[model samples]
Target: MGSVEVPSRHKALVYDSPGKISTKIEEIDTPKPGVGEVLVNLTHTGVCHSDMGVMCNSWAWLPAPTAQGQVGGHEGVGVVASLGPGTENSNVKVGDRVGIKWIASACGNCEPCLVGADANCTSAKISGYYTPGTFQQFALAPAHYVTPIPDSLASDMAAPMLCGGVTVYSALRKSGAKPGDWVVIPGAGGGLGHLALQIGARGMGFRMIGIDMGEKEQLVKDCGAEKFLNLANYSRDDEGTKKLVEDVKAITGGPGVAAVVVCTASNVAYAQGLSFLKFRGTLVCVGVPEGPSVPIATANPAAMLAQELRIVGSAVGNRQDAKETLDMAARGVVKTHFEVQPMDKLTEVFERMDKGKLQGRVVLDLSG
Candidate 1:
């Protein structure tokens, strides 16, 4: 590693208002990492749907809407530019390649942190939400919390894994479906779902059934799904639900799938997800619907009792999950379909995302 020039100011995407897509690139003072922190000169950052949620203030469950003027991005990949006055014990040094995730910093002394569930820490700092995020060219990250990106993985691909990959990886792990089990991933062509399909199929040895529109059939198949279900072919009524359930059962050899990971924010996806699960099956919820949308239709206790099903909610993954996901990417077991774009084109990307036109993830090239 070699010494690099440090800039006094850097360009950043600043949120202009709380509940809209108003952002402007402004030159802000570059921050110096305090004790126990390192400054990362970010090369690429993935534009995630959650970033849209924060910028728009759509989710009511958050502690509060994202404050105005906050920089919004969590999946940032870059090289360390400098280290703070830590007196040298953090095991991280200048020039090391690292990545920052959704969970910026968590108190390790908390109960959840002690058990390696730092995402649920009592006092956790969220990057791009409550703290300064990766939308800027340089950002400060906690030394112990930032993940080291492998040399084999390119920064553009590694950026999305820091959030979408690790998230769905953790969700699948929590689903408890073993190798050879039939696991279905709805919205299997989107950012998180596509990575989940690859990780579950190639890396974890599970047989994947990807459900999405007809247009994503090839993408889902290319990502290693054994079967692809085009949701557009089915109706949203009771008959459509029954047809989908029967289709899944037939694909799984007369029994329902062992688990179903719902990776889309569509309420209809959630309403139809439980029908794909087998007895004693698990349903892992990874995507959050905006506002007070329709609740899950299978939330009734009677239905849960009859099927012996388990429903679990998963937030963004922990550090271990991040490492494992990046390792999988480095080993070529999984890969992200992304297009690199200049930072100024972010608004157009968001428009595509809102219209359900994006095929996969989009990585922003901050250098431009």
Candidate 2:
């Protein structure tokens, strides 16, 4: 590929004080790639709930709250504008369309890396959190770690797949449900949930039961969900949880679902997730709740002993997962529903997200 000119400075959205709703569009020095790194001129990025969590200091497991002036965004798709010294050996050249994900870089020497679980690496660098993120037009990513975007997938569609799509794909793989088995996905109309529904039904051939608000009924069904349950119809008391479990039982003919993937951050979803699973069933936890939410109801030994339920927590997917997810999108088995908005409207998008009004993902046009 031919060399491209790069500017010394670029526009970026930065958090003035993490945990507070303060952000600014500032012009910052454009970062140059180092050895083993490539400079990506990001054209589009997906705004994720995790980005909000980082800015709001919501997650407890983070090493620390995101520092001030941190550039926060992980779901980015762009072309390589320049290659750094020594990156020639990496086989990633300038002009290649690539993607940056939540796991920015991981130490290859770590145990998790050796086991192909780089997302859990002990010394992993997180994009938009510990390291610089893709919110800006220009960002640096390790050549070995950046995902190669498939030519068939558009940049906006590919952005959310880098994180939300890969995440649910990993969770569905971990769910242990075979083709024709019933898999229940709570919060099935949101960004991650909608992708999970399509992947489960179309990609894996599993029967999908999507649970979400009433407004998302059409979307969930259109994505191939065999059954849709609206949580808005149920109360939040013990009776509501009982009704949800009963609804699952009814849909699955009393044996209950083979797997339950809770993709919502609401603790109420977690509290009732295991109840929807059959005996020896698996409940995969993907969404994380913040603050004073109660823990999962099936955490006790009695519940485990009686049901033999397996609870698994999944982080962002690895490189292999990213490749497979993009391939699925390329094949038309899974597609994201998103609105392309200019970068300046990100704060307003966040406000809409906070109100639980966003139907699907929101992709920011970085070039604007």
Candidate 3:
């Protein structure tokens, strides 16, 4: 990449108002790369559900620093088009097939970062949340924190791997289940859930049971899920929840699943997930409930103690996880099922996504 005079203006999608769903395409000044930064010409960016939550102001538990109205879309894949002064000191150079992930930058000296946990860094910048994200045609990324996407992977497919893929891939890896172990993935049809299903079952050799709606049976199975549970077909009544757990136990040979990862924000899913886990099994939490923190309605402390169950919470993954996600995608072991939507239709895309109508990921083509 060579230095070219940056134009004074560029197009950006702005979430103008809080409610009523408004996104305006306006001409904004092209931001200059700051020290230790590189400007990337974003080609493809994934429209994460969390971005929808931010635009609608529905995301709770996030510190005010992570709130939206800055810019949305964390998973961005593109070529480095500009580098700031002092950035050359780092190994990353211009024209790299790099990616901007959920974590834009982190202080490497932090205790968590020293232990390979960048996501927990005391000083962390999250793209599309904490910092200006990759929704525009050009966005600046920190050179030290940028992910080097392999040359073989397509930009459109590589975008989601930055956030959606890395988040779930890291969680699935933390499930403590080895080969042939049954792991249930609730909400297995959505972006993160679908990716988790594929990576856990196909890539990690775990026996996966996907729980979604009746309509997702084929798609979930197509993504390598060994079994499917339709939440729509079951009621919340005792018989319904009991039967669902029984079905999982039957499928997993009576001892039930080794672990359950609830990828949906529904408290019901998290509550029911524990029931399907065998004694000493783990129940992982990955979704943020709509409002605020509250104990799950169906959770029983006595039952948990009796079973010796483990409950864990996970957020976005780190740089190494991002690299492994891209590697899996590059090798074609993790196939991304997504569609490219032009920037203008982005509002409608968010609406449909909020309604839970989309079967696959919706990637935004910023160039359009």
Candidate 4:
């Protein structure tokens, strides 16, 4: 097979202590790719909130606590370094740029895989969890599963699109809102929300309403949100929720928006989701709430039946969704607002993300 000069060892950022924000940079031996896998020389990886959840052991839905010394990142972009056995017919080869997403590998024979719901595949291996992830210089991904990076898109720019971009696009599709319909995103200026706004407005033709802090107003508007609602302006009380619902109805004529895609982990956003949708509208749950899982406050059967509303959970997108998302990026219909940081700053980046201080996404330069 074609090859590149790969070193024996490489730098990796690992979660030194799970259930907390601690990371250590260490040199570890790089392994050769196994069957149907490719060794990737990762140049850039996006630091996502999901990684923070994995490190902190905060997401209750996960099967188990993250193991110590686990490399933690999913949105990785790199070039193929070497091919493993039985990959001669694969679409990717040595020197081709590719990306690894949340789902590192999936058994193509699974029911979910057959239906294009790879995130729910029974044998799915999630990167940055139990599987070795992309917070390292070298990582292994299935040759058939890696996403092809478009020539027009830079690796750093394409990193976040692998996870956050495709995730929101999938959630938007599940939202069931058509062109010219009004859709609400709770964390509209966030890493996922900003991309959702751009894709919904520019790519899918939906009119977006962004809800976030006052500081995020400009960014949300710039990302194509037709209206920005400051979350701080509304108190977390019944009266406040009523007022917000009324305001949403006023903004979208009478009833309410066609859908409310909650992109924040805040339970308050999930509670307010159902109240923002019109009759027969959908509430697509995208963000995973950390800590103990709580039921949505307004998801009672009465409320659900009153409007014939539907609520669906969306994980990361499938391979087709990833391709479509990248296509949109290559065509300039969507763009991620991000800052580049060295690998050592990952802890600080996670801290900022935990405190809701990040403006968009942060791509780690793994070359360090």
lDDT score for candidate 2 against the true structure? 0.91
Candidate lDDT scores, in order, read 0.90, 0.91, 0.83, 0.94
At residue 236, give the lDDT of candidate 2. 93
- Model 4: per-residue Cα lDDT over 88-147, one tens digit each: 998888999999999999998989989989989998999999998989999999999999
lDDT of 1 by residue, 1-368 (tens): 88657799999997888798767788999998898889999999999998988888988888887888899999999999998887278877888889999999999999998998898888999899989899889999999999999999999989999999999999999998999999999989999899999999998899999999888889999999999999888998989989998999999988798888999988888998888888999999999887787888977898899999999989888899899999999999989999999889887887788777888799999997
Which candidate should be chosen as best, given lDDT against the real structure?
Answer: 4
Error of 2 at 125 (Å): 0.4
RMSD of each candidate relative to the true structure: 1.1, 1.1, 1.8, 1.2
- Model 1: which residue pairs collide? none
Candidate 3 global TM-score: 0.95
Query: Which clashing pairs does model 4 show?
Result: none
TM-score, every prediction: 0.98, 0.98, 0.95, 0.98
Worst 10 residues of 4 by lDDT: 1-10
Q: What does candidate 2 score on TM?
A: 0.98
Better of 1 and 3 by lDDT: 1
Runs off by more than 4 Å, candidate 2: none
